[model samples]
Target: MFCYQCEQTTRGTACTTQGACGKTPDTAALQDLLVHAAQGISQYAHRLGKMGIRRNAADAFTLDALFTTVTNVNFDPDRLEGLLRNAAALRDTLRADYAQACAAAGQAPEALSGPATWEPAPDLAGLVAQGQAVGIDTRIAALGADLAGLQELVVYGLKGAAAYACHARLLGREDESVYAFVQEALTALAEDEPSVDALLSLSLRTGAMSVTVLALLDGANTGAYGHPVPTPVLMGHVRGKAILVSGHDLKDLEELLKQTEGTGINVYTHGEMLPAHGYPELKKYAHLVGHYGGAWQRQRSEFDAFPGAILMTTNCIQQPAPGYADRIFTSGLVAWPGVTHIADHDYAPVIQAALAADGFTDESPVRHHLAGFHHDAVLGVADKVIEAVKGGAIRHFTLIGGCDGAEGARSYYTDMAVALPQDTVVLTLGCGKFRVIDQDLGTVAGLPRLLDMGQCNDSYSAVKVALALSEAFGVGVNDLPLSLVISWYEQKAVAVLLALLHLGVKNIRLGPKLPAFVTPAVLKVLVEHYNIMPIGTVEDDLKAMGLAA
Candidate 1:
C-alpha cells in the first residue's frame, strides 16, 4: 500500500504501511485495485476510440474510478470493492465492444496484457489481493522512479480533472475530448515499455486536459447557478436547524438547499462550497445561510462543535470523529465506513438528521466575508484594473491559492496574503482561500485586495483573468505583473499545476512542499522547462515577487 500521490504523504515520502489521510492498508489496496481496473477498461476503451467507436460509459467509469482513488475521498473498503467490481464489469463490456468493432473493421483484435488481461477476484479480500499486485511500487519497479513518477504525475492530474468533470457532469455538462484523453492517457500508463519523453509530454497534455475540464466545470457551474458575483456571505450563522454542506459539489449543495428550503433548516456551505453563496440561483434561497467552519482540514473540530447535521459532498473528508461521526453523512463519491451514504442526491436522511439535532439556538453576531469574484466578476471590472495598473494604483497582482491541509507550514499562505503590499491585488481560489478571506486587505485597483474566485477548479478563473490582463496590457501572460503562489495538498492541485505549466506560465512558486513522488530528475525537467520552484519563506517570496513589504 505504497501511496504518495498527495502532498501530505508520510514524511514527504511514500506511505508504505498506511495513508497519512487515515486510509488503511486494506482501503489503499482497494483504491489501487480500482485504479488498475480502470486502466484495464481504458486499454479496451482507447482501442475502441481509435476504431471510430466511442465508449462513453467506459470513459465515465474510468474518471470516477480514478477520482475515487484520490486521497481522502473514499475510505470505505466496501464502497471501493463495489467500484472495483463495477470497473471489472465495465472493462468486460468495453473489451467485447472492442473485439466486435475490430471484427467489423476486419482488423485483428489485439490481446491486451497487464491489468487488461487480469481479473478481479470474487470477494473483497480477493479484490484487495488483486489490487495489491498492481500497486504504485509495481509500476516503480517496472519503469523505474523517473518515468513511473512522471506517469503517476499524469495520473494524479487526470484524477484532479476527473473530480472537476464529475462535478460538471452532475449539472449535465461534459466534453468528449476530456473523456477521450482519459482513455488515451490511461492506455499509455498501462504500457510496459513507457518512454520518459512521451510520459512527460503526456503530463503536459494531462495539464491541458485539466484546463479544459476546469473550463467545462466553470461553464457548468456558472451556467446552472449564474456567474459568481461580488456578494457578501455571512461568516456568522443564523438561528435554526442547520445542515453543513462541505466539499466542492455545487449540485449536491443545491439539492440539499432545495430540500431544506422552507423547512426551517439552514444550509451552510463549508470548505470549497463557500463560493456557492455568490451564485445568483443558489443565493436566491434565503435559507441557504452563511458559511460555517474553515477549510476541510478543520472539519473534525468544526463538525464536532456544530450542533447540526453534516453532509460531505466530495473529497476533503477526514476520518469522522466519534463525537459527531453519526451526525455526518456522505453524498456523491464521498464515503466512510459506517457513515450513511446518500444515493440519488436525496436529502431526506440529511434533513432528518438536521431536524433531529439541536438547532443553533443563539445566532452569532453579524459578520461577513467577501467571496465570489470569479473571472467574469473580475473581468467585468477589467477597465479599472487596467487603469489601476497604468496609474500605479496596483503595483502587482499575486494569485495565492490552492488546497488547505493541516500542515503547520500552510500558514505561509496567510502570511504572504497578509504581507502583500496594499497596491497588489490578491486573487485567490480553492479551499486555501480560508487563510486569506478573513483579512480585510481593503480595496486595490478599485476592487477588494483579496478576491475569492470560487473553488479549486476556479483556478481557471485566475488563468482567465491573467490572460485578460495580459491582452489588455498588450503583453504575454508571463509578462503581466503577476505571480502564482500555489499551495497544493492533493491531486487536484497537481492537476491545476499541470494546467499552469501547459499554459506556459512560468516562475511560479509552489509549496507547502513538493510532491514526494516527483523524482529529482523529473523536478529538474519541470524547473528547467517551466521555471517552477518550491516556495521559500514568505519574506523571500515577497521579495522575489518584487514586493518590498
Candidate 2:
C-alpha cells in the first residue's frame, strides 16, 4: 500500500509499508478500493444527471464514501468492506438507470469502460486484487505524475467539500449545485484521458465548489446554534462525571449536550470543538464546561487521563490506545475496529459509559481562554479596527491557521505567533491555533490580540473578514497589510488553500512542507501564478511579513 495524501507521509514521501497515521496495509488497500468504487459510482451518477435524473442517495453516498477515505477517519476494515459493497451496489443501480434513460430517449446506450465497466469480485480478497489493479502508481504511470497529482488534488478537494457538505446536510441544509459539482468532478477524474490543463481548471472549480459548501455549512451552524460571540471558556478540570466531545461536528456536540444536561455530567470541548463554547445556543448549557486539551494529535495522552467518556464526532481520530479504547466512542462516519460507535444520534450508551467510568473527583483551578471572534464579531468592530490601523496603533494583521499535526516543524506557528509585535493582530482558525492559544497576546484597540475563528471550514469567516476589510479600505484583499501563514495536514486544508488561490489571495506561506502528491511542475505553476511560498524560520517569515521582530 502506498499512501501520501497527508502532511506526515513518511519522510515527506510515500508511506509504502504502514501509514504514518497508523493505517495498516490492509486498511490502506481498502481505502484505495473505496475511492475507486466511489469513482465508479460517480461515472454513472454523472451520466444520470445529464439525463435529467437526480438521486440524492447516490450523491450522499459519494460524499460519505470519500469522507471515510480521509486520513485517520476510519481504520475499521469491516466498515470499509461494507462501504465498498454499498458503492458497487449503488454503481450498478445507477448504470441500469443510465441505460434505461438512453433507451427511452431512442438512443443506443454507450458502452463504458474503466471503472464503469469493471465488476467487483464476491469477497475481500477479490476486492483487494481489484484495488491493486487500479492503484495510484498505475494512474501515475499512465498519466505521469504531473497530471496524476492534479487529478488527485481535485479529488482531495472534493473530499474536503463533501465532508463539510455532510455536516451541513445533518442540519437540513442541501445545495443541489454542490452535489452536482461533486459528481461531475469525480466523473471527470475517472475519464479515459485527462489533460493537465483541464485537470488544473477542474481543480480550481473544485475550490470554488468548496467555497460554496463551506458557506452553506456556515449558515447551517450559525442558524442552528446562533452566531458565535466572544465568550471565555475554562481550560481546567471540572468536578463530577465528564464527557469530552472532539472533532468538528456541531450537531453531534449539541445532541450530546442536550442528553447530558441535568444528568450531573459535564461536557468539555476538545480539539476542533473548542470553538463551540462561543456559540450562544451551545454556551447557554451550564454543564458545557471548558476546553480540555490541545489539538487532535495529543488525544492519546489527553483521552487516557481524562477519566470520563469521549466522543469523537468526526475525522482526525487516531488509533486508540488500549487504556482508553473501550471508553472512547465514535460517531458520524468515524470508526475503529473495536471502538463503540453511536448511530441514530443516541447517547444512552455514551452517558452510561461516562457514569461507569471514574470522573473527576475535585476540580482543578480554572483558567480561561477567549474565543468566538468569527466574521460577525470581527466585522462588528470594523470601525475600531480601521481606526487603529489608520492611527498606526495596529501595524499589521496576520492569519496563522490550518490543520495541526505531530510534525516538529509545526512549532514554527507558535514561535511566529509569539514573536509578532504587540501592535499586530493575529487571526487564527482550525486546530493549529492550539500552538499559540495558551499565550495571552493582550488587547489591541479593545480587541483580543488573537481572534479565534471557528474551525478550518471557518476559513470562510476569515475570508469574509478580509473581503470586508478590503471594501472598507477601498482596496483589494492582497493590498491590505495582512499575511496568511498556514500549516496544513489534511484534505480540508487543501480545499481551503485552493479557495484562497481561487480568490486571487497572494503571498500566502504554507508549511511544514509541501504536499508530496504535488509534482514539481504543479508546484512551479502555483508559485508562478499565486506567488505561494513555503515557510522559512520564524524570524525570517516575520521580517518578510514586514514585522520588526
Candidate 3:
C-alpha cells in the first residue's frame, strides 16, 4: 500500500506497510481501489452532466462513495467492498446510457466498457519506481511537480467536501447536484490526458463547492440546534458515570447524549467535539459534561487513562491504546479494522459499550474543560463585542487556529499568541488551540478575549462572526478590523479556505509553509487572486496587522 494523504504519513514520506493512523496495508489498498472506482463512475457522470443527462440518484451515491474513501474516514473492509461494487454498477449503467444516447444521435460510441478492476499499486517499491519514472520523463517531468501538487489539492479538497456533506447528511439535508459535481471532479483526475488548466479550474470549483457545503452544514447545525450562546461549561468535577465523545460529528454526540440520558451515563466532549458544548440544544443536556482530552493526536495516552468509553465521530483517529480499545466506539466515516463500529450512525451499540465499560470509577474525579461556542451564541453578545471594540477595550480580533500536528514548529503558535498585545482578542477553532489556548489572554471587560469557537467545522462559525462583524461595522468582511492567522494540516482546512475564497475573503495569513503539495502555478493563483500570505515570525505578522511587535 502506498498512501501519503495525511499529516501522519509514516516518517513524513509514504505508508508502505501500515498507516501511522492504524490503517493496515489491506485497508489502504482497498481505499485506493475505492477511490479509483469512484473516479471511473465520476468520469461517466461528468460526461452525463455535460450532455445534460442528469442522474441525481447516481450522483449522490457517487459522492458518498468518494467521501467514504477519505483518510481515516472509513476503515470497514466490508463497507469499502460494498461501495466498490456500487460504484462499478453505477459506472456500467452510465456507460450503457451514454452509448444509447450516442446511438440516437447517429454517432459511433467509443468502447470503454469494463467490470472496473483496480489492484493495489504493487507495493511501496513499485510506487517509488513509478515516481522515478515520472522523474526521468523530460517533457512530462517538466510538469510533474505541478501535477502532483494539484492532485494533492484536489484530493484534500474532496476530503473536506466529503466531511461537510456527511454533516449535512446527518441533518437530513441532501444536495444531489453537489454529490454529482464531486463524482465528476474525481473522475476527471483519472483521465490519461491530464489538463493543467482543467484541473486548476476544478480546484477553484472545489473551493466554490466548499462555500456551498459550509452553508449547508451551518444551516443544518444552527437550524436543528438553536444558535450557539455564551453559556459557561463546567470545568469542575461532576458526580456520575461519564462517556467522552470526540471528533467532529455533532449528530453522533447529540445521539449519544440522548441514548445515555437518565441512564446515569454522563457525556463529555473531547477534541473537535469540544465545540459541541457551545450549541444551545446540546448545552441543555444536564448530563453533557466537560472536555476530557486535549486534542485528537493525544488520544493514545488520554483515552487510555480515561475511565469511560471514547466515541470518535470523524478524522484524527489514531490507534487505540489497549486501555481504551474495547471502550472506543467509532461512528460515521472513522474506522479501525477491529474496533466496534456504530454503523448507520446508531447509538444502541455505543450505549451498550458505555454500559459495559466501567465509566468513571466514581463520578468524574474532576471537570477540567469548557465547550459550546457556536455562532448564534457568539452573535447574541455581538452588541457587547461591538461596543467593546468601539470603546477601544478590545483593540484587535486575532483568529489563531487550525489542525494540530506532530511537528515541533507548531510551538510557533503558542509563542505567537504570547506576542499578541494585551488588548487583542484571540479567537480559536480546531485542535490548533493546543498551542496557547490555555493561556489567560485576559478579558475585555467581563468577557475572556480568548474565545474558543468550537472545532474546524466551527470554522463556519468564524466565517459567520466575520460577516456579522462586517455588517455591524458597516464594512466588508475584509475591511473589518479582524485578521485570520490560520494553520492547516488537512483537507477540511482546504474546504474552509475555499469557502473564504468564495466569499472573496482576502489577506488571510496562513502558515507552517503553505501546504508542500500546492503547485507553483496554483500557488500563484492563490496569492494573486486571494492575497493569501504565509506566517512569518508571530511578531512580524502581528506588526503587519498594525499591532506593536
Candidate 4:
C-alpha cells in the first residue's frame, strides 16, 4: 500500500507499509479502491455532460466517496468497501445514462478506456487487490513521476473542493459548476497520458472551483448560523456533564446542541469547532458552553483526559484509543473501526454517553479566547483597520493559518506568531490556531492583534478580508502588507492553496514541509509559476516578508 496525500506521510515521502495517521495497509487499500471507483464514475459523469445530461443528483455521492478517502477521515474498511460498491454501481448507471443520452442526441457513444470502463471485484480482498493494481505507485510507474504527480495534484485539489462543496450542499447551497469540475478533473486523471501543461491548467482550474466552493460554504454557514462576531469563549470548562464536539462541521454541532438543550449536558467545541462559539445562532444555545482541547492531533490524550462523551464531526479524526474509545462517537463522514458512528446525526447516544460519564466537579478559574473575526465582523471595522495601517499603528499582517499536526516543526508557526513585531496583526484559522490560541497579542488601535476567523472551512473569510483590504488600499493583494504562512496537512489545504494560486497571490510560505506527492520537477514548475516558497526560520521568513528586516 502507498499513500502520500497528507503532510505527515512517512519519512516526508510515501507511506508504503502503514500510514502515519494510524491508517492500516488494509484501510489504505480500501481508500485507494474507493477513490479509483469514484474516478470511474466521474469519467461517465463528465462525458454525459457534453450531451447535456446533468446528474447533479449523483454529485453528493461522488463528493462523499472522495472525501472519505481524505487523511484521518473514514478509516473503517467496511465503510470504504460500501462506498466502493456504491461507486461501481454509480459508474455503471452513469455509463448507461451516457449511452442513452448520446442515442437521444443522435450521436454515437464513444467507447471509454482506463477507469472509465474498469470493473471492480466483488469482495473486499479482491477489491484490495484491484486497488493495488491502480494505486498511486502504479500510476507513477505507468505515467512517470512528473505527469503522475501533476495528475495526483489535480485530484487532491478536487478532493478538497468536493469536501467543501459537500458542506455547502448540507447547508442548502449547491453549485453544478463545482460538481462539473470534479468530474472533469477526475476524467482527466483517468487518461493514460495527459499532457503536463494540461494537468497544470486543470489543477489551477480546481483552485478556481475551490474558491467558489469555499464562498458557497461560507455563505451557507453564515446564512444558517449568522455572521460570527467578536465573542469571547471560555477556555475553561463549566461544571456539568459535557460532550466535546470536534472537527469543522457546524451543522452537526448545531443539531447536537439543539437535541441536548436543557438536557443538563454541556456541549463544548473542540479542534476546528472552536469557532462555533462566535456564531450567534449556535452561541445562543444556553447549553452550548465552551471550548475544550486544541487541534485534532492532540485528541487522543485530550479525549482520554476529558471525562465526558466526545463527538467527532467530518474529517480530522485520528484512531481512537481504548482509554476514551468507549465514550467516543463519530458523526457525519468521520468514522473509526470500533467507535460508534451516527450517520443520521442523532445525538441521543452522545447525550447518553455524556450523562454516563463523570461530570466536571466544579468550575475552574475563568480563562477566555477571542474568536469570530469573520469577514463581515472584520470588515465592519475595516475603516478602523485601514486608518491604523495608514497611521503606521499596524506594521504587517501575517496569516498563520491552515491545518495543525503532531510533527515538531509546526512550532514554527507558534514562534512566528509570538515573535511578530508588536504592531503586526495576526490572522489565524483551522486547527493550527492551537499553536497560538492562547497568545495574548493585545490590540492595535482598538483592533485585536490576533484575529480568529473561524475554522479552516471559513478560510474564505480570510481571503475576502484580504481582497477587501487590497481594494481599500488601492493595491493588488500581492502588494498589500500581508503574508500567508499556510500549514497544510491533507487535501483540503491543497484545495485552499490552489485557490490562492488561482488568485495569483504569490510568495506564499507553505510548511512544515512540502507535499511528498509533489515531485521536484512539479515543484520547480509551481515555484516558477506561483513563486510559492518553503517556510524558513521565523526570523528569516519574517525579514523576507518585511516583518523584521
The clash numbers for all candidates, in the given order, read 0, 0, 10, 0
Q: What value of lDDT does candidate 4 attain over all alpha carbons?
A: 0.88
TM per prediction: 0.98, 0.98, 0.87, 0.98
If both were scored by lDDT, which would come out higher, candidate 2 or candidate 3? 2
Tell me the whole-model lDDT of each prediction, alpha carbons only.
0.88, 0.89, 0.73, 0.88
Identify the runs in model 1 with alpha carbons over 4 angstroms from their true place. none
Which residue pairs come into collision in candidate 4?
Answer: none
Clashing pairs in 2: none
Q: Which ranges in model 3 have alpha carbons more than 4 Å from their true place?
A: 8-18, 49-57, 76-78, 97-143, 192-195, 362-370, 472-476, 520-525
lDDT of 1 by residue, 1-549 (tens): 899999989999889888889999999989888887888888998888877788778867888898898888999998888888788788888888888888898989998898898787988888888778888898789779997798889889989989989988989998888888998888888874688788888999998899899899889988999999989899879888999988888888888888887899988888898899999999999998799989988999999999999999899899999988989999888999999999998889989999999989998889898888999999998888888889999899898899888899988999998898889988899988988888889987567888899899788899899988888899998999999998899999989999989999999898988898889998899889998999999888887888965
Candidate 4 local lDDT, 135-250, one digit each (tens): 88987897888887888898899888888988888899998888787887887777645888888899889899999999999999999999999899998798989999988888
lDDT of 2 by residue, 517-545 (tens): 99889999889989889999988888788
lDDT of 1 at 254: 82
Residue 463, model 4: lDDT of: 93
In terms of TM-score, how similar is model 3 to the real structure?
0.87
* Best-performing candidate as measured by lDDT: 2
How does model 1 score by TM-score?
A: 0.98
Give the better candidate number (1 or 3) by lDDT.
1
